[model samples]
Target: MGAFTRYATAGALVLASLPVAASARAASATAAPAVTGAARADVTVPEAWGTLIAAGRAGKRGIAFGDCPESEMLPESLRCGTFSVPVDYAHPFGPRIELAVSRRAATGDAAERQGALVYDPGGPGAASITFPLVGEWSAWRKTARAYDLVGYAPRGVAPSPALSCRRPEEAAGTPTDAPQQPSYAYKRERIVLARAYTDGCVRAAGPALRHYSSLDGARDLDVLRAALGEPRLTFMGTDQGAYVGALYATLFPSHVRRMVFDSPLDPDARRVGYRAGLARSRALESRFGDFLSWVARHDDVYGLGTTADAVRGHYDRLRAEVSRNPAGGTVGTAQLQAAFLNAAFYDDYWAMRASALAAYAQGDPEPLVTQASPRPYTAKGDENADAVRTAVECNDGVWPADWRVWDRDHTRAARQAPFAAWAGAWANLPCASWPRPRQDPLDVRTGRGALPPVLVLAAERDGVTPYAGAVELRRRLYGAVLVTERDAGSHGIGGADNACVNTHLETYLLTGRVPARDAECAPHREPNALALNRAVPRGTGPQHILRGDPAPAGS
Candidate 1:
């Protein structure tokens, strides 16, 4: 089908599914009164959604505790199951898909049990089936003990019907040796690759491509909520997953008991496709400056440089070298960019990343190669994660149809913000030629007092899902109390061992008492290289914890 036809079909399906009065209310944002807790009963769910919830409950089955290939590393206490959801909620009786789910029962007595705390760890495509296992070592430990911890691999992730577009080797195309100011030829080549990748996804998934959006994921969450026999949902999501939680609460306002969003996506900025990427690039540039300065201060240990510019100069040389010759025959410019881009996510990674760069400069590429290795969640050559991320992001909002628009915007961004501008642009380039039509961005703005207060945690300088997004989300969601970790720069905040952030989060989760006003907490102490070098084992440190990798024994 043509793009326009697909757009109309998808739009029509969604509109047809909504109750006429709710549709009208949605169209006129002002028509709905401020729905406070006392008036929450007035909120009504769409008939289509109610039907799906009913169907889900009827089909709900108990989770069976068993061994699986991926579960060996997971805690044995965790149990796995599959929850059936329609591939296309627009057509509820249509082809169905199963979401892989894992659950850890509350450790506390029956009276202490609150409800299921369904969690999603950030990536639109990140595998979350192991989250319950990981939560045991995370800041969620207290919350996990009091509530049943639930994790699910959203549709199109492994153990679910995954979307695969290319093989691992083919997906990692050769690195470009283009200058920071890329040539027009490089831009054109990127567009070609984007189109080819989009075409591959179209050929692989066909009509189902349009269904893999955050909107659909939100609907799936409601279904999962019903299957668990919960009257309301208690959710925690980070990064892009935060966007999913926001969408869910918007669609099912009355069903939300409590929710938390860490490092949230700006729903408003995300609708304007390029704006989100630009914001991310600028944040990365600012955070990169911080990383450079930190390394400069630790020059005695890293010996890279003693000034920020000097450190950047050394980095540029490394990039140039890697562009020409892939480190360890695999860590090329692409892998190098991916590796350093992570530093922007968490400050804890600064020391390790600096150490890796220093080692690479001295002709030992092993550490750099290992640092750039594919993350456990995206280990399928990252193809599935990349594909799902592309699908959700492209389908979530309207991307510029004309490639020239993207070329112009990114070229300008690259000039001002050289850190990851082009890399971010190319990572999302597939959207320029995505096979599916873009849907109108969901209107998440609710009437004042529409829902219970939400807790938003953000770091002052978080690059991935910048802090500004948390502010935007707080503004959009009425009564959302934002807890800022002043001067910190971590993507996921609650579980990084910040006593201040964790206390507020734990307090809210245990008792629904939000701070009378928004609050700020001091940033965690910076990593100490000397102390770290002497104390930390070879590979285990804050990097693994921040990355959500399996913890070391006794962690």
Candidate 2:
């Protein structure tokens, strides 16, 4: 249905799985002691947002990130441009990385200019270029529009050098159960191929791959700020991007203006080793359980089962059979399991899940194949899945160089989750054998300057950022608030249009008044069994059926 899985990949391992993901921390630097979970219990809210200690104005110019959607175009006042940054900040002159950057200036009378508002749309790989152009309605957009709204693609990501594999063969191995597809003989073959593919990137990535670290990625944001000629930067980051914000705010505290990170990632988790990855898998399953339960109740939509337990057993058996004998030569346990990866993100995607299940029950290979293809089906499909994901995810933290740990955890996850365990492992395993030596991730605690504190948002049930991880970021950051959306699910934060979270986000984004105390949002109800929005006569309104962003003020 699309090129690459949704950034909202379900933890294809672990079971309710004990919440394997939320509490992850980045690996720390040499001697900085790490903070304990307890320290995060206290949350801080800042004063006013974008309260100008100073001012700067901009000319009527649109910064280009890429061509705007053919549908959207503004003359000079708002444009797009690319900023050339040091691939490795330490080596400013050697190799340059260009960030696809964009900006939309304040409405009128430029003299009372505030500052620049930059955004990161999660996904160590999601696109942020369109953010500013579309930011007018964001809860924070009014304040942001008070200045310039800036956007940039991370290194190795789209519009940015775009790490890609060129072809599926580059991804290697046919789809089949890990055991049956690989056999012991195939395992040896895969090992060789994996090493070769990773090796190719080492030679090809040039110096850019080494610098894609969040810390370096943060530097890229700093470069964006410098190019804007702003004294400081006001940033808005969601999900994985929160990690980017933390690293930047910490690294360039004096350069920081006001920052807002929704769906925070643990800085320590980003800097840590394999153990955190495995733990997050379990946390992810808890989020998935909510999905499974919803699926069971809707037995009519998907005949998967009538009860949650039965639905689990059914999916487990279905995938296990494919492991032993792929339905066709094409679909295997990994591919089948990977098909459901988006379940961890939005409840709206349950439509995709129902489709996948129905296709499996019919034993059709099309749905599975579509899900498995890392790129797309054009004359020249996408290759970035392999390169971009690996370049950023792998270097961000050190995966245990040992296969033994991966194997042990993979086995444990298979037993516990049965559905997603091994599949996710294979989807991301190339990193284990990557050719380049790993860079130690930065704990990113640079609370040494005058950056205004930030507001961090997270849902308690989010499998990705996890409530615990948001707490962690608050602890490590100099002056950041951890405002919990107590009962939501998936990777929601700034990404949500939910009024519950949106109000808090809006208040903080509008002015830097975070809830004086840590707050809890109402839990999200699962996907609509019936439509929830205002009635549109059949397809009469907003022709597209997919749900709009959940954040009300923004969406």
Candidate 3:
């Protein structure tokens, strides 16, 4: 809602849930082309493409000619390359931008290998080029071997003409309002900050801002599909990546072969889909209750409280104390909330978060601070990550331009999900004043057109792209089947360790089948609580950065 956490890494695993497809078939290389460049079929290629085409085709693989960048640390089997496409699809052959792509060839028998599986790891901002790391995810190992895995840097993200504000430090700044009732001055400060950020983004990104939306990314995917010599796209998208996949399907249904939309955003077609943010706030509040219950049950271990209210009281007290005297002079109430919100996103982190909180209550807060510190916004090449996130979201849909709307909504949500509502609102405040013209939100239903059966997976307790949104997507796509992981408090269930979910996922990726009906699966057994707690040594700050991904919007 406010900002999706960058939580797609690590615990983002998929498992078996729905029954495996009845049959499996290897994709044929000779499948008829559905529609080449349907995404840009109406546009006329400019003369400028002639020379570019000749040079691109000079190599062994015409149009697909590319070699891995020397800078990339990837397996020898994976190849990387760059491709040029028009900045604006309608004006093909106009100004062009190069997008970086990495490919892992299918490991299955040559005859059984399917088309490339283009992936978008959500953040709308995070680099998808990290597919090499997917091996550790386990759930995707079979998928990785079954089809060529494709990862690309979305336009405006780093390594693809990233757009960073000239005042990178200011552009990278994050609003740090603690979880409390905001004073009039605090509200005004947010407004001013939002204006400043919007202005900086415009100065930094210039015309590039208009082409960074998910819609544009979808079109880019089609272009990449053509370049790969694929008849249709086979995609695996998680988090906001799911949103891009959904948009691509809606915009070019005939061009999709198979798609997996995991932890997807609700395909509500509205310009400025701020209501989804509200929906996420409600989900977070719901999961927070679960955290309270778990903490209460483990009171003997955490020593925080025996009742949920008592546990919550300890949290509130710590927040008040931090507000008065910021913990370690580095951590404040806002940082504390951000650090702990990770617990609500993944149950596996519950004990660690509880341990951090218990340590804070006993007068050591450094562990929490280390976990919640704002990400290094000014890191080289990353100054524009936040900016790209803002631009794409703002341009894709209309965020209410009026402060009053945001104030009312955030105020109501904070009452329940105090940990994230306001902070999330502040995360996207730049959208209110985004200079780009907003496009109407897309209606991603597949009922109007022919679309292959698609798969949608969600966790019953995901706070980022809540389960409700997944249900909505399942309903909108006539042939889509929804898979749920019961009691799994996670954002990306597909990448989770649940064997059941992984089995189902494998069946789908390897075969072209999903269960005929919507289905649910049990959560993977949690790790030993005592073991998890023991691992978080007592009376010491975290030795490394305890980073948590903010749940992304749309996806």
Query: What TM-scores do the predictions have?
Result: 0.86, 0.75, 0.83
Which segments of model 2 are wrong by more than 4 Å? 1-78, 105-113, 136-147, 165-190, 269-273, 320-331, 355-375, 378-382, 435-437, 446-450, 530-555
- Candidate that beats the other on TM-score, 1 or 2, i.e. the better one: 1
lDDT tens digits by residue: candidate 1, 176-277: 353567788887888888898888878777887887788778778777776676767899888878888988878777678899998889888444456788
Worst 10 residues of 3 by lDDT: 20-29
Listed per candidate, the RMSD to the true structure in angstroms reads 5.9, 11.7, 9.8
Please identify model 1 stretches exceeding 4 Å from their true place: 1-47, 50-72, 172-179, 269-272, 373-381, 530-555
Task: Give candidate 3 misplaced runs (Cα > 4 Å).
Answer: 1-72, 75-77, 166-176, 374-382, 530-555
Cα lDDT tens digits for candidate 3, 259-363:
999888877775235877777778887887788888888877888888988988988888888787776665677666766776776666677777777887887
Candidate closest to the true structure, highest lDDT: 1
Sort by lDDT, best first.
1, 3, 2
Worst 10 residues of 2 by lDDT: 45-54
Q: What is the overall TM-score of model 3 with all chains considered together?
A: 0.83
Task: At residue 59, give the lDDT of candidate 2.
Answer: 12
